[model samples]
Target: LGLALDKPLVAVETLAALAYNLYDTEGLVCPIMDARRRQVYTGIYRFAGHRLETVSGQEAIGMDELLGKLEGLDGPVTFLGDGVPIFRRQIEETFCQPFSFAPPHLGRQRAGAVGALGMQYYKEGKIQTAAEHRPEYLRVSQAERERAERERRAQEGQG
Candidate 1:
């Protein structure tokens, strides 16, 4: 609605905002959004005092791969976001390091966190014109994949 309201926009990375949900906690923070096909949109973060620092940038990756990356990091991890519920069992079964899931109240996406992060970004001169703002989708949509597959099959038929 920034465009409609003629207001400058601040783009808060979803994973970063989700990690901010645990700004008060110690150790590593992981925010995992279910990206389907057994993959998640995730990032590793830690709070250096009150400032959140990125241990790993957000990306679309399989749960196994993410777990593997976490194994190399020091200290316990606190996981949050939609992927927690879906991957909890697997994480418990496979992850070797100590970890805990965020309680239900703080597990999912929250607008408050996003707004707070957005405000921080604005203070840091990260604001952009509404026309310059764009949503970041970490991977191609299912529809796009399906369309590509269909084109490939059509080319095969022609050959």
Candidate 2:
């Protein structure tokens, strides 16, 4: 751990790292992780002179909604991540712009990609102490949603 090593920690955003997997590719890079319930953890990105630029920030969003946002963007989009296999059919049926899936070998999350991006962040002075790091979940967990629903039902019954 960075704390034990006395080194600053460089946190790389998941979606950004996923998009980095396609660093050599051209056009837009869309990394979509299956978030279930017809939604995905995704973001739109593009490379500008070896620097990865975020066209859209990461978020947990519906597949349809994500597609809608991509619809307006120009150029062919390269899709990757676990969500591709799950939503391939829907994307084929609904998406009008040109697109292609990353080959299986490069489709999923890779540690190399994360490390590479982490290094980029580190060089850019984005390092932080381990205690200052935090995970960005993008949305509440399913268990939390279920607990809230149960609480609401109990309140309704008591009322």
Compare the candidates by TM-score and give the number of the best one. 2
Model 1 C-alpha lDDT versus the unseen true structure:
0.91
What lDDT tens digits, residue by residue, belong to model 2 across residues 1-159? 888888888989989998999896789999999998899999999998888888999999999999999999987999998998899999999999999999877877799999998888888899999888898889998899999999999999999
Model 1, 94-155: lDDT tens digits are: 99999999997787778988888788788889999899988888998999999999999999
User: What are the lDDT figures for the candidates, one per model?
Assistant: 0.91, 0.91
User: Against the true structure, candidate 2 has what lDDT?
Assistant: 0.91
- TM-score, model 2 to reference: 0.90
Clashes of each: 0, 0
Collision pairs in model 1: none
